[model samples]
Target: MIHLFLGGARSGKSSLAEALCHRWPGQVVYVATARSHPSMAERIELHRRRRPQSWHCVEEPLALARLLAEAGEDQLLLIDCLTLWLTNQMMAGACLDQATEGLIGALSACRAEVVLVSTEVGQGLIPDDPMSRAFVVAAGELHQGIARVADRVSFCQAGHPIPVKGERP
Candidate 1:
């Protein structure tokens, strides 16, 4: 099964995703896409503190498709947030369309249950900067593509999840 959680920053989407992973019967792999940086240290630490040590964690800023393809059927893969992965791709000047396609293909082929968390960044005012605008567009497109393939989709608001597609867990 594939589940997707979407919301604005700090909307508790990650917390919800973690909760779902906790309920999985098999091993849970926490695939963290965010790169460590001084600005995000506190946020990263907060997430680290919340996750159980028993959950195997992999920090992959890129090559997510490769990782997904290697996952075993006995595992549940929880990708913390896709937006940061998108940012990493953008920063590396990677082709957005190709990367997105690879990820979707991996999702389709993956035997393991997967849960993805992503921030909804396109609802606000247009960005004044070109890169920021591009990021927003890319994120929005990625979210839509995932939503189309996701078996379950939920939108988070003020720490509450609202089911958007399929049955809630």
Candidate 2:
């Protein structure tokens, strides 16, 4: 099963994803994509502290498809956020289309249940700069694409989750 969870910053999307992982009877892999910059070091530490010690952590800023391909059928993979991954790719000057296609293809072929958490960036006002605007547009499109392929989609608001498409607990 593929689940897509979307919310704004500090909306408890990650917490929700972690909670959902408990339902799966298999090893849980936390695939984090955030890079540890000076400004985000504290944020990184806080996230690490909150996650379960038993869950395996994989920090892959890109090439998620390759990681997904290596996952065991009995494992459950939770990708913390796609926004950082996209940012990493953009900063690295990687081919966005190819990378996204690869990720989608891998998700479709993977046997293990996958859960993706991402920020909803489309609700805000359009950016003034061209690059920022482009990033927002791309991120919005990517979120929509993933949601389309996801078996379930949920929106998180102020620490509460409302199922957009699929069953809720």
Candidate 3:
């Protein structure tokens, strides 16, 4: 099963995704895309501490499709956030279309239950900067693409999840 969870920053999307991972009767693989930069290193550590120790962590800033392909069938894969992954790809000069296609293909072919968490960045005013605007557009498009293919989709607000597709949690 593929589930897409969307929320704004600090909206408890990651916690919701982690909780859903417990539903799967298999090992959990947490794919973290956030890089530990000097400014956000403490935030990263706090997130790491919140996750369960039993869940295996895979730090992939890019090449999401390859990592998905490598996961075991008896494992549940949870991607913490797609925004960071997209940012990494953009910074690395990756072909956006190819990367998006590759990720969608991999998600379709993977046997393991997959849960994706992403920020809902398009619900605000447009950015004045070109790069920021481009990122917001790309992230919004990516979020839509994933939601279309996912079996379930949800949105979180104030730590409360409201089902947008499929049954309520």
Return the top candidate by lDDT: 1
Off by over 4 Å in 2: none
The predicted structure with the larger TM-score, 1 or 2, is 1
User: Which residue pairs overlap in candidate 2's backbone?
Assistant: none
Instruction: Estimate the lDDT of model 1.
Output: 0.93
Question: Global lDDT of each model?
Answer: 0.93, 0.88, 0.88
Candidate 2 lDDT tens digits, 1-169: 8998999999989889889997777799999999879988987888789888898999999878999898888999999889999888889998777778778888888988999999988898999998789789878878878877889999999998899988763
Tens digit per residue, CA lDDT, model 1, 13-40: 9999999888887899999999999998
> Would you estimate the TM-scores of all the predictions?
0.98, 0.96, 0.95
lDDT of 3: 0.88
* Alpha-carbon runs more than 4 Å astray in model 3: none
For candidate 2, the TM-score is 0.96
Instruction: Show pairs that collide, candidate 1.
Output: none
